[model samples]
Target chain A: DAGVTQSPTHLIKTRGQQVTLRCSPKSGHDTVSWYQQALGQGPQFIFQYYEEEERQRGNFPDRFSGHQFPNYSSELNVNALLLGDSALYLCASSPVGGADEKLFFGSGTQLSVL
Target chain B: AQSVTQPDIHITVSEGASLELRCNYSYGATPYLFWYVQSPGQGLQLLLKYFSGDTLVQGIKGFEAEFKRSQSSFNLRKPSVHWSDAAEYFCAVAPDISGGYNKLIFGAGTRLAVHP
Candidate 1:
């Protein structure tokens, strides 16, 4: 079975610009969550999408948003990017009620803000 | 608030040597703990997890973690370290919230380097 997949392994954006990263959850999974891993740091939770609606969110600002489609794919959008926004954006997925404690992650999209 | 702490920023060991990485977490109730490994340019891989029942959990690739409730710590250990075992290790905790889904709180991570 295919594992979690993310698009545009790497991306570049300038300050005040916008960017969107994509994620396709593992087969048989329905929930998608996003995380941000800064240099020399572990990933921090961004938000989670289930049933096409956001269920929980972390300490991110309004500029960061996400969407989950019927197919279980997800997209994370960052508006008005700042230099601090440069980091590895990771996508993780899990089944709604099955072993929710375990999450499968994608390689992640490296976002570089200039 | 739930949080994880991996005190070691980096550790180096010789091949064939034993290894141990320390992890601690803070949570009000019983916590769901996990250990994940990440290679350069790769995603996080679950090594093992502790929900309940047993304090010592065995995981893939010769990894094992022991969760101590009194200490509020979960430490990963391996009998023998391989060169390929070198990678960044993350300790995480999942707080049980209202929703069915649990969000993970990760530590700063401990980078392991193996010398042959």
Candidate 2:
């Protein structure tokens, strides 16, 4: 009912600094996934958190990491941010591990890596 | 590996006109396709999805997408576009790996502009 919610609608960070974005999945949902959407481009998969562990990951580097809590909330951390890391970081939530899952997205955190 | 391609970057149409956005995907098996719409500074909203049944899936907002396995494409369509329909549309494919649904792979997106 509440849908997916993200914190710090926007953020600003300098190079070599780190930032953490938070996400609260929709009610009655458990799995949380993170995505990065660059300007003029679609979102690219970052990683997925299920059962408090990272279950699946995309082609992103190790600098990108995430955590899922018991309450099903998630946090995405980016270390040693680069200028290219400036993009919209989106958080999505889905239900069980079924083959057909529907993802609900949050407005996203606009990360501006200066 | 999975990927999606939206051929049109931007499309402009007058109000009350029909709309069609093209999407193509590359995957190993039957792809689970989806269409999402995003407004400025907003998250992607699911319009419709294709899992198995019908080739034509109807979504909220009067949107419909046709999944063509032969062409490896899923195109979105809407009749009588409204001004509010002007927004970014994204086509995505969910990769099935190890008996689990993986995160979606999205296209560059198509931006629609409607003139009143």
Error of 2 at B114 (Å): 0.4
| Candidate 1 lDDT by residue in tens digits, B1-116 | 77888999999999999999999999988777889999998999999988889789999999999989899999999999999999999998887645543589999999999999
Off by over 4 Å in 2: A97-100, B97-102
Q: Cα miss at A29, model 2 (Å)?
A: 0.5
State which candidate has the highest DockQ.
Answer: 1
TM-score between candidate 1 chain A and the true chain A? 0.97
For residues A4-47, what per-residue lDDT tens digits would candidate 1 score against the true structure?
A: 99999999999999999999999989999999999999999999
Task: For candidate 1, state the interface root-mean-square deviation in angstroms to 1 decimal.
Answer: 1.4
A6-104: candidate 2 lDDT, tens digit per residue: 999999999999999999998888899899999999999999899899988998999999889999999999999999999999999888655336888
Error of 2 at B22 (Å): 0.1
Ten-residue region with minimum lDDT total, candidate 1 chain A: A94-103
